[model samples]
Target: MKKHIFLFAIVCITQFIYSQNDNIPEKKTQKGFGKIDFLSIKMPETTIPNESNMGFTGIHYNLMMNDWSYAGLGIYGAVTGERGGFFTLGINAGIKKYFTNNFYLDTGFHFGGGGGKSAPDGGGAFILPHFNLGYNFKDLSINSGWSYVNFFDGGEIKGHQLNVGLEIPLDFSYADYDVAENDYSFDGLQKSNWNVNSKKSSLMLHLNNLEIKGDDTNKNVQNFGRATIRLAGFEIASYLSKNWFTFVKFDGAYDGIKAGYMDVFLGGGYHLPFNKNRTNILAKFGVGAGGGGGVDSQGGFLIYPDISIEQKIFDAFFISVNKGYVMSPNSHFYTSSYGLGLKYYVERNGIISDENSFSEGIFKGIEVITKQDLYFNAKRDGEPTEDMHQISVQINFDLNKNLYIAGQTSFANFGNAGAYAEGIVGLGMQTNPFINDKTSFFAQVLGGAAGGGDISTGEGFIVKPSAGFNYQLNNTLSLRTAAGYVKAKGGDLSSPFINLGIKYNLSFLKMN
Candidate 1:
């Protein structure tokens, strides 16, 4: 089945990419507002075996189209019912139907994979269909309505519930880099006229070594031993001021610990520059959630604080070293950690205004893709070989015209195994377009932490290698498909897989 899917994906990709006409239309891009929403849902007596009510917290970001339709990604995590580590990540799309005077109906659907804490989310495939009656005030809106949650691949968890949510709209601007460079006017500074003055953003990757605090004294720590554990993670930062910034960070265990351990933090930091603007001293504080790997994290809530020094190395790039402390305010998990990292400064594209955002520049492009994967004959602990399905979101940052860095997060959506997930980072390269400039070939290799779902990914380290073609649909959208092999480094899990995806391309221009 997996092999068939792979061949089918290859054929589809080839056909789509090579089918473009010689005279493709000139793409007219638009400016719009994106949105981020916070949501909550409660289920009654729906949990498997225990028949307990469950509570979930969700976050999602969407890009609004010219017609007000939107598509994006979302993640939901269980915050109650002893399901702290249970979470799902997936793609979403819907629209808002407006009525009279600030009132509207928001409807959408979420489909993804995830499960944890022995929940019967068989294969982790789930769907959520919902609708909300909302009222908008300026840039914010509040709503509540009915939602149906079901893990349909092979699970007994299903229920209907009331859902409440809040939405905040944000600035979004996009254009094809090549088109913008050739068509837009350039100012005295050699920057495009569509460029805006905004704060720079950053992406950083780190390797951390943590020493468990009071391993023998703390039961949670004792269960995992006093040995140091190594983690790999990434951080994203957006400046609020010259010296202040807000950041989101996520890390997963890959060495000296089980693979299922992971944490995410949201926090702020201050940076002080020195040494002729080449060095910076930073202090950061963060609080968020974590759990799994048999570590008690008190419902997955945690706090982390750290300090570091960053030294500029090249254009828009830096190197850093940091020391930090991690602790669960409500549990016995604590650690003192040190790590190294690589940082890249990203330009914010577009001019901000009251109603829209516009940014045009010749800059590095970024591609955001959502993919569905099928794995064949995948192995699991004490279970027979079975086919599996997964949903993943991948981000690619261009290094040049043909090379890029990629990061991805994946969750199992089917195959009789729930709570399965993977986080990966790697590098890729693409060939120039052929067949009337519509298609391109690409290849990449990724490795990272993967475990859970009873799959035999010993210690949670796995690697994937894939090759595919992308078919450009327009200036901002494309179709992608790939065939790959996934194998665990320390476990017996292995499989051949196929991926189908949709890609959105945009540029993050340098601050004007």
Candidate 2:
């Protein structure tokens, strides 16, 4: 396994170096310009004994001048051991070039590999033949290709391999032969422009089949043979300038059980274009339906409506709010939920398209408090009481122009007076997942801490890692709900908590 991983790394680095050649347009060529590239490779799926998986890491450097390509020695290695004590080593060399803007070919021979003998015997040699197809617009480039590996004396390990990968150049530089003044700039402007033009579409098709078996009294059920089908979906949109443009999208899901259900959404919105680029507000509305029990059955219609607001603060974070309503009767048996959510985006995109923005700095306001309490008290030899209240607050930070981090803190004050504050804090990485719009998703993790009080004499911390899917509804209001496990430390009793809540976002206050 180690040997195989090492060889794979060498191939990856070689490819990266070849791809980074200076493919710039120029006028004169008294002295041809060259380019240097570095590549990294990752193994697909391979498991070793007592080890999670066997993989290799490689770094290759290549230089390209005119049509002649030269690559030096590459180094790679793999780690394989039982829990601990693992080692690896590898080496390789190769030469490659592009025949066209989209097609390239290469041939490489790799040797020298090693792995842990006690861990697992994973070693092999190979002669690799590679072919690649690539498309470049501005700064964005997409490449996919396959390679054939001929193993030298390895058991059942020589065959053609097919894999796909993507490359996102964090910084790009090009040489200009037309002018003798300076090389190209790495300001990321060209790369950003390329990203705007080379946008691809996403196609999504979902089919669900469900089975239920239980009595109406308990409502307890089991699921079986729930077939899920996902088809390709596509969309294409680009930025006009900074944060303003028009976009159209088509997304829907279908299920083939219990009268089935289907939903389709198609709508678009643009940035306000006035409050610098740090603040973006958008609205989307679409129509969808669900039905199954044959055509005679009454098919229900649904309205997909949402609004989103994003604001940046300081220079290292941001905050956003979303609210929306979904009216559907097929699934969840004629149920409707209105939701509001708040989030923070951190480590921004390093661009400040706007400076004098009103939504700058951190938006810190008096925390909003909402509570629901349940009490049970007894008067006798002993007194017992229990109550719970939910409290929530929204926080926003200005990470940069294109990035920000948002979060929500919610706690359940058990009202035991002595019971420690028990609640959950949700932290999410926010990004605009739509084209020319501010629609985004929050990848979050929830956790909390508890202290021993009069009610329960114990102390400990609680951590729950959870993931939630959120859609921005509109400005001022947002909807959010999440499910996560609850663990108690210092004590023995623990239970998971399912949380749901709505928030109202208020911003741009005058400071006294």
Best candidate, TM-score-wise? 1
lDDT, candidate 2, 262-333, per-residue tens: 222334445453465567675656443321211111223345555656666644233545455444423322
Question: What's the residue-level lDDT of 219 in candidate 1?
Answer: 74
lDDT (0 to 1) per candidate:
0.75, 0.32
lDDT, candidate 1, 1-512, per-residue tens: 99999999999876654442211213234433333333344433443454446567677777676455777788776654556567688878888778867998989898888877667788898898889898988778888888888888877778788888878775555547443222232332133334345556799988877778873679766687776777788899988777899898877777777667777777899989898768999999997666666666645557889999999998668899999988777546788879999998755554443322334334457889999989888888878878888899999988788889998888888887688888889999998779888899999999888877887888888999999999999877899999999999888888899999998887644432
RMSD of each: 11.1, 23.5
The candidate that wins on lDDT is 1
TM-score of every prediction relative to native: 0.85, 0.26
lDDT of 1: 0.75
